[model samples]
Target: MTTLTRTLTDTQVVAKRNLLKIVRVPEILVAVLISPIMFVLLFAYVFGGAIDPGDGTSYREFLIPGIFAQTVVFGATFTGAGIAEDMQKGIIDRFRSLPMSQSAVLAGRTLSDVVYNVLSLLIMALTGLLVGWRVRGSLLDAAAAFGLLLVFAYAVSWIMALVGVLVPSVEVINNASFIVIMPLTFVSNAFVPLDSFPPALRVFVEWNPVSTLTQACRELFGNTNPAAPVSDAWSMQNPALYTLICVVVILVVFAPLAIARYRRTSR
Candidate 1:
């Protein structure tokens, strides 16, 4: 076999081995499974009545895409926590001593987490459907919307994994990651229209990645119209562009940092 082919084979083997560990410990899957459902239930019943979407759609429809964004963001915290646990247990140290590609360890963990994210989204989508959350867009648009969400989720996973490598304890990983993520989720348009916020708050909300992602998904699902004014010169124009930009920004900023931190920690 060619050297390139051999390298690819080795990475795949390492990735598969990590995935096998996930299969044996089903609780990891369970935690991923429960989070999205909890978000749907808590937000749909609790805060749905308080929010005015202005589009005349039921609150549930208006909120699903936002909840999808929020859930994926919340779900990413596990990436760091899991990695920290493995490191503390010496699993990562042992892997470092092996003749495997350095990238494979982080790649495997992040990719596996993406699979878990997909399953979580699927389950939440099914539950949302049962509760009357319908996508008004075409099937292609719905698929595109979901595809973007997964891409965003995967991008965020790298950042979270970097935190895992840098933090001294798994407990810190659990608390500190959410302290950053939860505020971003709440301060954005996820739970309310950005117009309702005061001017100072509105500026921050406009630039938030979670808001951009939610607006993109909402437009894709036809839950809200793109031509409608979110603010002056910001009408949710070009949702695909927004998703693309967020994904690119995240990958460009976090990918190298994650790799560098992993290499340093694994040493």
Candidate 2:
């Protein structure tokens, strides 16, 4: 078999192992499905009225995409934590003794988490609809929006996989990832208007990958702000393209780094 085929076959096995853990442990599903719903409720009812999303749109509409973006990015913590747990428990050593592809372990861990994110997205989409958020875009466009989210998420999962290999402690992964992810999500266009942000801060918010992801979703879902001035930044002007670029760059930079860490640290 070719190298690509060998890697893919081994990856499937690792992915299956990770997926089986989710099936055996019901609570993981509950927590993954519940938290996004809770975020929808808390933000929709509590802060919806407080945050104005311009004249034509409701805060609920604005909040849904932001929430989705935040949740997916936060989902990376699960990837990191899983890897760290495996390392802490010495499961990596056992995997190393096998003759499978070295890349399969990290590849499988990240790929399995894509399923987790997909489930979270579906649950969140249903919850958003129940709370009166609608997707006004064509079905194809909506699918593209969701595809962007999962793609970006899949790429970031590799970064977390590296962190897991390096850190090897579940508790530390959570704390360390939070310090990095929290700011990226909050300081972006997720929960608030870009106009309200000062010029200096707005620059960063406009270009932040998190913000572009949020913009791309809003445009695809037809939830954009009509009253606000049009953004001209390269990132905001062409969010879908920009988001694709970010995903590619993230994967290129992190995938090799993660695989190297897995090979070195797993042994």
Candidate 3:
């Protein structure tokens, strides 16, 4: 077989092994299933009232896409933590001693996590609907919104996976990596509009990738109130382009770095 085919075969093997492990350890799946629901409740009821959406729409409608972005970004931290755990338990060392493709192990972990992220997004979406959030866009637009979220989640997973391979301990990975992401999520237009912030903070919030993704999702979902600015720009124009650019930028920067780090660490 060709090198590319051999690599893909190994990736599939690793992915299957991880899937089996996920099945055996039901708690992992359960945690992924439950956390997003909890976030939907906590944010919608507790903080929703405090935030002004300014378009006569229920706060839940505005909050759903933001929650989706936040939850997926937060979920990525586990990618690193899981890798660290495997390394600590010598699972990674065992994989290294085998002749399997070097990049497959990390690729499998990331791919499995991407599947996990999709489930999480579905749970959040259902809960959002139950709480009176509706997608006003056409079916195609809704699908595109979801597709972009998944793409962004996958890109974030690779960056987190690199952290997993490099960090010495799961505890450190769990604590440190999320500190950066949490700020990235909250500082943006995820929970509220950027104009509401002070002039200094407004700049950071406007430029955040989370803000960009959430705005793009809002547009795709047909949240068009030109008077209702989610940021300096709320128009749906070019949302697909922006989402594509963000995905490409993230994949370009993080994917190779993650693979290189995994190969070196595994050796």
Model 3 superposed RMSD (Cα): 2.0
lDDT of 2: 0.91
Better of 1 and 3 by TM-score: 3
**TM-score leader:** 2
Off by over 4 Å in 1: 1-11, 225-228, 233-235
TM-score of 2: 0.97
Off by over 4 Å in 2: none
Best by lDDT: 2
Reference-based lDDT, each prediction: 0.82, 0.91, 0.82
Ten contiguous residues with the weakest lDDT in model 2: 223-232
What TM-score, over all chains together, does every model reach? 0.92, 0.97, 0.93
**Worst lDDT 10-window in candidate 3:** 229-238
Per-residue lDDT of 174-244 in model 3, one digit per residue for the tens? 77786779798989877876677898987677666788888888878876455764443432245457667
Of the candidates numbered 2 and 3, which has the greater lDDT value?
Answer: 2
Model 3 per-residue lDDT at 89: 89
lDDT by residue (tens digit), candidate 1, 189-257: 888887888989887788778888888888788888555566542524555676678789888888788
